[model samples]
Target: MNGLNTTALVLLIIGGINWLLVGLFQFDLVAALFGGQDGIIARIIYVIVGICALYAFTFIPAVKRRHAVE
Candidate 1:
């Protein structure tokens, strides 16, 4: 689970950077690296990143636990 969390975090960071680039410069690093946006590879990359983002939800610290520290 730790490994999975780390992997998901890394992918999430990459996705965050990609979104930052898109917002600031209208660039898409993944699409360029994997071909064009419609390319199968690019679509797969996007899908994986999205899934990683979803997986990242598991890493969220529980609010109750945070307040339970003694």
Candidate 2:
């Protein structure tokens, strides 16, 4: 993938891992690293990740098309 896709995928992975940590151990890596959930930096990161998730949905049709070709 290109740079934007790679960045989005990485952020998605980070978000996924954060969710896993929250599910299993009640931890939030991003908040802990940046500050608490209410911290400005943490909130910015959360917003970016959410935006990336929406961007990722745009890939679904391409993925389906690729799979259908195969």
Candidate 3:
């Protein structure tokens, strides 16, 4: 559970940064490295990141637990 949460968090951060780059500079880092939006690798990365964001949603319970501890 800990590992999954950590992985999800990392992926989520990556996705967030990617979005920031897009919004600020009109650049798509993931697509650029992987070869554009239609590229196979880029699509896979988008899917993986999307899944990670969804998975991270489950961490809300863990977050509550941590805050409760404090």
TM-score to native of every candidate shown: 0.84, 0.96, 0.89
Local accuracy of candidate 2 as per-residue lDDT tens digits, 1-70: 8999999999999999999999999999999999999999999999999999999998999899999999
lDDT of 1 at 35: 91
- Pairs clashing within candidate 2: none
Candidate numbers sorted by TM-score from highest down: 2, 3, 1
**CA lDDT of every candidate:** 0.87, 0.97, 0.92
Question: In candidate 1, which residue pairs get closer than 3 Å at backbone N, Cα or C atoms, i.e. clash?
Answer: none
Q: Taking the candidates one at a time, how many backbone clashes does each contain?
A: 0, 0, 0
**Largest lDDT belongs to which candidate?**
2
Model 1 is weakest, by summed lDDT over 10 consecutive residues, at 56-65
Residue 29 error, candidate 1, Å: 0.4
Off by over 4 Å in 3: none
Q: Could you tell me the lDDT of residue 58 within candidate 1?
A: 65
Best by TM-score: 2
